[model samples]
Target: EVKGDGRAEDAYLLATPYNRRVAERLAGAELRLDEPPPPAAATALPNIFALYEENIGAITPLIADELKDAEERYPPQWIEAAFREAVSLNKRSWRYIHSILRRWEAEGPDYEEAGRDPEADWLERRYARGKRGAGRLR
Candidate 1:
């Protein structure tokens, strides 16, 4: 049964065999699935750990260490994008995601088919160049 606050307590979760397993997993994760993601520039995306668990698999110790290392080096949005790109490519491993992020960092993101308008980009660059040139004496 749920509490008056409509929240399920450990007692309720532990009462069921399946829910007991879920409770144990949650305890191991140290993160609540119901809690909002930590504040970041991109708040719309799901929490990184939850997203990984849902899309990939349970976060083993080695994987958790890798995630922490990646978090230190990459922005949350880059991580999210890498995950998306991996899933799109049907390569759902963290290694694939890491490689995507590394490639983006070293070579820049490939904007082709990423919902960008090449004409608009060219125009923007042209406008910027015009502004810069206007300030110089020809």
Candidate 2:
């Protein structure tokens, strides 16, 4: 049993009955009292776009499920407003996603289309370009 910050030197003495039980359990499990365990493995670096995509995918299904449930409880206009808010928030959340895509397009395979403006994703491009002003949406 270990105490006082669980250092190796502290393992020499068992301090309490609980400690004794822990030590006995450890012995029963056949864990060696030799050296400290190996350090945990390093975590992978995060890809912001991949994270954004994963979050978007997770939230979409959840929102869909919630909408199905919520429609019965709320008025049509209230539900519509809630749905609009959800959609607006989700659409706005893609700023980081578009930034990552733009960065990848700049550095990765598609260099030529790095900041190309297409009609479909113009909102993202506009937001990325810092076109949104104070209280514009409100």
Taken over the whole model, the C-alpha lDDT of each candidate is: 0.71, 0.46
Kindly list the per-residue Cα lDDT of model 1 for residues 59-134, writing each as its tens digit: 9999998888888888777888778766765677888788878998898866445686534665677677687557
Can you give the lDDT of residue 115 in candidate 2? 73
Top candidate (TM-score): 1
For model 1, the superposed segments whose C-alpha errors exceed 4 Å read 1-44, 111-138
**lDDT by residue (tens digit), candidate 2, 1-138:** 332333333355458889777777654343345659999987744332233344555446655554345445434433333233334446434434344344444565232355743333656655665665533442
Query: Clashing residue pairs, candidate 2?
Result: none
Native-to-model Cα distance after best TM-score fit, residue 88 in candidate 1, in Å: 1.3
Name the regions of candidate 2 deviating beyond 4 angstroms. 1-9, 12-20, 27-33, 44-58, 61-92, 108-138
